[model samples]
Target: MATLEIKEVAKRYGDRTVLHDINLTLASGEFLSLLGPSGCGKTTLLRIIAGFEHPDGGQVRVDGQDITALPANRRQMGMVFQAYSLFPNMTAEENVRFGLRVRKVDAAEQSRRVLELLELVGLANHAAKYPHQLSGGQQQRVALARALAIRPSLLLLDEPLSALDAKVRVQLREEIRRIQRETGITTVFVTHDQEEALSISDRVAVMYEGRMVQVGAPAAIYQEPTHPFVAQFIGISSRLPARVVDADQGVITVLDRALHTPRARGLQPDVALHLYLRPEGVQLQAVNGKDPQSAVLQGTVRESTFFGAVTRLRVELDGGQGVLADLSTHEALQLPIGIRVHVSWQPDAMRLLPAELPI
Candidate 1:
């Protein structure tokens, strides 16, 4: 276990800047995920930390030592890339033992360590199976075991699960988290998948256009996003156009209702804003009467998607704007596409962000 620090790290490729002045710190054994879209620089930052790429400025430190100039092999870190990268002719045991053999560890110790890691990754029974004989998931497990064989001070994963199928990805991610906790190795995971990052990380760092936009625990980042990009990128949410009708009272008009949000407190009147309404915050009701006077809003379902316990819907409102409503699977059965329904939201669940956004 070790504390990792990245201080003012910046990177550039010719005229294009790959990373901005980024600063982050992780406690011993802490697991942090860098999450963003395809070109958002998360991978670049990970490579910089892994010593594969040098930053134009700043430093990378582990346990108070500035290792910015250290070669990757000397950094004492284990890395798992998206590709399994296992040796084709080598069996699981031999693959995991390769690092130990290169480091000139005692032969007896290498055998013990290889077996221990193969067991740790739940591959002890398949130790003699070559890479070609293993499934994608199994091959990844061997790669993970090989990386852990060195008992590295740090573990870096660059979307290691992306190449696998969805179901396998979930299972392997959970397995990875368990292995991480058992080993207590400080880990830096880079991925574009929000669910993966949110599900298994101690903390999540959201980056956009090479800048770290927000960093927080999973729930905090989901519930209280500080940036508009963070709010939009992290989950499914609807943005209803609104206007700040009364800033003095922190009031904003959404559809027909005047809702109060602290974010509207200092905004000028009539300034355009977007009210972020999460699907889970909405409640759908059958319209039994004309006008539906008790309803907060009304819309026709544009899309309905059932996700096990809950069903998410895209409801198109009166003026072509839309909001997503999440309903019980039983209730969603009653409402299909093009069905009109009443929509009401829990005020505490909505968030307000600046209407304008970066391109």
Candidate 2:
């Protein structure tokens, strides 16, 4: 395992700039994920780290050694792409041994390593099968085994499971995590799948248009997003128009409404603000009941959809504040559709975002 450091990295294609002053430090043996939408330069960043692409500026250091000038093959990095790039003619065992053979490892040691890796990936029995004889998931496992065979210092995965079916993707993702944990190799995984990043990564870097918008644990990024773009991108968070009517004593009044809540003090007053709340944070109650400790929104349930585990309701506030609330199926069993109910949320569940970003 090796520590990976990227400092002031920038990339450009002719006149168009793709990456700008990117800086990150990855701990050794950590499962870090680079997450973003398409064209966000995540793959470009990964290629730069793997020595497949060069940066126009800045440096890349691995294990305290500057490797910005090294070729991809000399960098001792393993890479797995979205497509399983396996040798078509060779059997699984032979394909995995290709790297060892290239380095002139003895036959006895090569056989032992191949058997170990095939067994490690649960492909020992299928070692004789060629790439065309395996399923998508099986082929990917073979690819992973082949990548690990070289004992590379860093493993770079670029959407390695995107080509699999939904069920296979889920299963293979877990398998990949298990393999990574057992091997303890420093890895960098790049993907556009938010759920995959949130579920698998020890730390996630949320990139946007070539810059990292947010970087933190999955829970922190989802619950306490520092940016509006992050709050809107990470999960199902709704933004309502608000203003900081009272910035003293850590209190703020929800503008256009009579609700008051405690917030971070020292924000500009009477300015436009966005109040973020997650779907699960909102609580629904019968119209006859009252909850004084909660901030209430009087709204008729505009639409309700059964989602097996949860029933989602779209509520439109009387003053035009729109929000969505999710109730568990068991909780919504007795409630009917179109029922006018009071929707409320705790004060702490609301997140505040700047009206105009300083950046």
lDDT of 2 by residue, 21-110 (tens): 999999889999999899999999999999989999989999999999999989989899999999999999999999999989999999
Count of backbone collisions within predicted model 1: 0
Cα RMSD (angstroms) for every candidate in the order listed: 2.0, 1.7
- In terms of TM-score, the best-performing candidate is 2
Per-residue lDDT tens digits for candidate 1, residues 1-359, read 99999999999999999899999999999999999999999999999888999999999999999999998989999999999999998999999999999999999999999988888888899999999999999999999988998889999999999999999999999999999999999999999999999999999999999999999999999998878899899998888888998999998888867666677887889978788888898888767676554467778998988899998888898788888888898989898898888887776568887788743
What TM-score against the true fold does each predicted structure earn? 0.94, 0.95
Give lDDT per model, in order. Answer: 0.91, 0.87
Could you tell me the lDDT of residue 122 within candidate 2? 98
Off by over 4 Å in 2: 253-255, 289-293, 356-359
